[model samples]
Target chain A: MTSLVIAGKTFHSRLFLGTGKFSSNQLMQQAIETSGTEMVTVAMKRVDLHTPEDNMLEYINKETIQLLPNTSGARNAREAVFAAQMMQEIFETNWLKLEIHPDPRYLLPDPVETLKATEELVKLGFVVLPYISADPVLCKLLEEVGAATVMPLGAPIGSNKGLRTKDLLEIIIEQSNIPVVVDAGIGAPSHAAEAMEIGADAVLINTAIAVAGDPNVMAQAFKMAVESGRMAYEAQLATPHREADASSPLTAFLD
Target chain B: MNLKLEILNHNNMNIIINNNSREVAEGCTLERLIDEIGYKEFKFAVAVNNQVVKKTAWDETILYDGDKVIVIKAVSGG
Candidate 1:
């Protein structure tokens, strides 16, 4: 029911989808539509640049979906900055997902480069949503640098590990001045629910839904889970106590 | 006779776009190159010599012989 307002734009869905790993572009479209996500991430690469046919954008319903281009292949600040500028120039959206991972194996975010790029991108008048490790201090620094939101990973990208960095993510979510979007390592709808229960403004998922037996059905499931989790959080579920007491009371004093 | 000879003498510049060698009209601008490549409806970015050539500069930016141009598309990624 509640909308997520990020960078002055309101999103009706708290579940943001990543457009990758689908069997086909058509399938990806079906999943995206079923998920009801307003924002989706796209990656830029040299191979796709030369081939005009089979372009991914053709499948995305741009009228309904807002494209969030990511700096996925960039390994440092300079490369990420270049990718961001290129993405804005081409995609016609200033919203950028700044991801700089020098490591090819785990695809972890480089905190130093992310900080450097965020500061630079903010100064360039771009709405920056940076993906980083679930480091609370980094989240604060990114906020100070004027990032639109902080997207911290629950685990390594595409690992399907499901919230391996739960403690760090909770700290970030608790202290973040900007929206904390839980991104990466979410294997199932339950993982999304867990992230939402902890007060994440949004959860970004890709590999989990894309690789499911039925991606469209899985998308719907995640959407429902995210909505239910957000609703539960808003309702203020009662906290559990360390010890249980009898409803009638264990004993009466000096009766 | 002179017009036919001039037309036949004209040379197209050879350049590498996204690692594919192609020939374009002499003194072609990056804007013209994009138009020639039939990417009018698609969203893409251009880089020459590993340096990004901004969209604002496309019209005035001339492509030189043997320049390495990279055209990239924003596809699905996580």
Candidate 2:
């Protein structure tokens, strides 16, 4: 497998997992270990004083997998910045997945707020990965603002519609100076393979694996799919021709 | 006479924790507040009036009346 380097750190697996929507923490751990993802995202929430909760951090083996705490519920830059600071204190890792989507219905990332947060977070010494729409210009601007990576969504988050923004993603991938991680809306292994084949540096998956009938098996499948796609990309896929050229020895059967 | 003064102090020390009005003893620190709620065992971050209070500062950071304390921690997310 080819390596993915982001912010001077190398990741052998191109897959990044999200720690959410799992049937159980043990299952999530098993699936994560099965998938061999180098990084996983976790969100921040207020602890309910009434209920005793299980800390998911104990289940994740920090010795192997890096924790990427995200600012998921933050509606704007200020909230995001605050969350990022708390995440820094809790996780003790400067790596952050900056997501600012004010609209709850679609969870579409607010591009303006995302950009603003990225600038501030980057300045605060956080290795910022801003999730954004598949806009090439925005990707370029984010890169200019010192984002470690640009995570452009394949579709609306958790929608699993699969690469609704393929054309635009291609543009972003082509022009991006930093890694382009195709995050969100990847519903199937094929979707992951497609993103990898298109030269995406990596892909972040959540719903497809977490909500699967068998998430462990699904994670294994996704791992293989990502590897296959990346291999095909590295080997340089062959171009298609409009008309078929007679390259096969079909006439040899008669001989 | 002492019981009356203690009751009055408790009434005067009311603060909002996670948006719920509650009363704490006079000179209650952030550490004591979290310890009372059994959160000291867990890994969490606290913000007093929208400013993040580091864990090291929790011991000396005292809670005042009507103070808004937001305690947050890592949860599952994508």
The DockQ leader among the candidates is: 2
On a 0 to 100 scale, what is the lDDT of residue A110 in model 1? 97
| Cα deviation of A33, candidate 1, in Å | 1.2
Q: What TM-score results for chain B in every one of the models?
A: 0.84, 0.83
- Best-fitting candidate, measured by lDDT? 2
lDDT of 1 by residue, A105-154 (tens): 99999999999999999999889999999999999999999999999999
Residue range B1-78, candidate 2, lDDT tens digits: 999998887656888878888888778999998888885557888899999999999999988988999888778889
Candidate 2 collision pairs: none
Candidate 2, residue B35: Cα displacement in angstroms equals 1.3
Q: For every candidate structure, what is the RMSD over all alpha carbons to the true structure, in angstroms?
A: 3.4, 1.8
Using Cα atoms, each model's DockQ against the true complex is 0.61, 0.79
- What's the lDDT for residue B26 in model 1? 82
Count of clashes, each model: 0, 0
Q: Which regions of candidate 1 fall more than 4 Å away from where they truly are?
A: A47-52, A245-255, B1-10, B54-57
What lDDT tens digits, residue by residue, belong to model 2 across residues A1-255? 679999999999999999899989998999899999999999888878899888889899998998999999899999999999999888989999999999999899999999999999899899999999999999999999999999999999899999999999999988988999999999999999999999999999999999999999999999999999999999999888999877777665656
TM-score of 1: 0.90
